[model samples]
Target: IRDFPTLMTKARICDEDGKAKSSYYKAMNDKKGKGLDRGKPYENKGNGN
Candidate 1:
């Protein structure tokens, strides 16, 4: 969300329902929150590898 603040805005511009798909949205959910951060960048614990 913070990383791509204009994502939602761009999606809504063409589609009022905000259901339209674009490259930005494709790349966003593509990760499936694998590296998403709720607080700090290291909040999600892992081997960091």
Candidate 2:
């Protein structure tokens, strides 16, 4: 949940029309565990730093 803002910001960098930003919020607020607030710890899929 806390990362949503940063995610939206990064998304906006790729999509300047704000489409990704809007969708991101929608997904985060979505019901069930399908949203960003799925109550799971974030996993870093990137290379371990």
Q: For each candidate, what is the lDDT?
A: 0.67, 0.71
lDDT for 35 (candidate 2): 64
Model 2 per-residue lDDT tens digits across residues 1-49: 3789998887777786577788878878775476665554656556584
Model 2: CA > 4 A from native: 1-17, 31-49
Best by lDDT: 2
Candidate 1 ranges with C-alpha deviation above 4 Å: 1-21, 36-49
The TM-score of candidate 2 is 0.29
Please state the error at residue 11 of candidate 1 in Å: 17
- Each model's TM-score, in the order given? 0.24, 0.29
Candidate number achieving the greatest TM-score relative to the actual structure: 2
Q: Lowest-lDDT window of 10 residues in candidate 1?
A: 16-25
Model 2 misses residue 42 by how many Å? 33
